[model samples]
Target: MAARKKWYSQGLRFSCTGCGYCCSGRPGYVYVNDEEIAQISQYLGLETAEFLSRFTRETHRERSLNERPNGDCVFLDPISRSCRIYPLRPRQCRTFPFWNSNLRRPRDWEDVCRTCPGCGKGPVFSYETIEELRRVIDL
Candidate 1:
């Protein structure tokens, strides 16, 4: 049988406005793998162990970036409202609004659009691209 088409099969537009909405005002995990951790550590000029100790916390046997007391991502600059480590941000951070959770239904995408200003702006991402990104992380 043929596969079912998704609500966003045509595509969706998104371009990060650097608004920081996805990085703050909520308690969530920004998971990082070993390679990402290493890259971020080197980018910050810190040893891997030091970076892990200072910037990450273990939860459910996985490593996640630490959040500020108010639930803002640690890398989010409160004054600038931009990511401090954008160059080497984790896969989870890089795949915003394309996660499985957000693409599961039209309603879910709408909710994402409400919270993320970039959701319906900029270049259109094809279904193939969305599926590739959605497979990167479950979210």
Candidate 2:
């Protein structure tokens, strides 16, 4: 008997090598939602309002996570090359190259892929995971 092909085998694949390159330097906007904000605040042991005031900035009327003066994410631990708030990270961070709503064209992903070696190659995610991301981001 032949095994059924995975959804990823039809199309789409990505594996995060955990290089941390994508989490470094001023790359692009990292949008956050209210629920995510609350989760991160709780994770940091801070009040939701306090966390937002301390770690986020308003841009174009939207709240975005703050970046360090050197351009890295505020939550990025330089020594570990990992996100201190990984578990509570926002949906934007959760959904990367698979941001279907923002990925209207291949060019939209070029810059991201250029900075992230993990892009365009890696693990094959199930369609369920992709759909979950879409739901999380309201895409």
Candidate 3:
């Protein structure tokens, strides 16, 4: 019989280095569900409707946070490279590189790690832990 492979059998570690590399570069959507929008709105002390209108935009049937003209996220502070709503950031933002797409293959993760200093460099996550984080991605 062969031993089964665990989710992160190779062992993965990650910690944000605060370089803000993930928050900028290339235009992308940060999808936020209604509950997330409400949390963020409460964090910012705004009503749900106001927060949605002021900080997000609709695309087809989905809603995502707006971005600066240069592609940086609206919540990212350019000068300090810090998220204004760090605690209440969207689910996608909270999950970081743990998204299934990046974890699907070793090469894919390496590709993402190239610029993200935090990807391969911090606390090692157990398979269970990694799976939990992956599960919440876009949820």
Candidate 4:
């Protein structure tokens, strides 16, 4: 049997402020599967091959969106602080603070919140809502 999940009794609240903090200040993998890459490529009006060559790097044999040397995600708009291809962004980008890792412990959530002003603010989400995001289903 699987271990039960630890849930936040207080529920959770968050809203993206378009601050770009999530897209900036860290070199981390934005892991993307083929379906996501195709979606993003179509959104950007690029051929899949061109998109793969320009926007991603091979990460342990899987593809992940590359970040600039300064740590900003390649699609993070310098002026607007918005994702360039918001609608077709990878599932990893859509999940945000609702990921299973972030929801596992109170301190884990707080730890992530330090870098993300959006993590603990704005509209509250019920347990079910958060669970949906964590499951990587429709957002």
Give the TM-scores of the predictions, in the order they appear.
0.96, 0.76, 0.90, 0.89
Give the C-alpha miss distance for residue 103 in model 2, angstroms: 3.2
Between candidates 2 and 4, name the one with more favorable TM-score.
Answer: 4
Q: Taking the tens digit of each residue's C-alpha lDDT, what string does model 1 give over 14-35? A: 9999899999998989999999
Write one digit per residue (lDDT tens) for candidate 2, span 1-139: 9976533444456788777776777556688877888889989999988998999988775788998877888889989889999887787777776776534555755656777787778776666776566566643
Task: Please list the C-alpha lDDT of all candidates, in the order they appear.
Answer: 0.92, 0.74, 0.86, 0.85
Candidate 2, poorest ten consecutive residues by summed lDDT: 4-13
| lDDT winner, 1 or 3 | 1
> In angstroms, how far off is 34's CA in candidate 1?
0.4
Alpha-carbon error at 138 in model 2, in Å? 7.2
Q: Pick the candidate with the highest TM-score.
A: 1
**Could you list the CA RMSD of all candidates, in the order they appear?**
1.0, 5.4, 2.2, 2.9
Please rank every candidate by lDDT, starting with the best: 1, 3, 4, 2
Segments in model 2 whose C-alpha atoms lie over 4 Å from true places? 1-9, 107-111, 126-135
For candidate 2, what's the RMSD? Answer: 5.4
What value does the lDDT take at residue 119 in candidate 4?
Answer: 85
lDDT of 2 at 30: 80
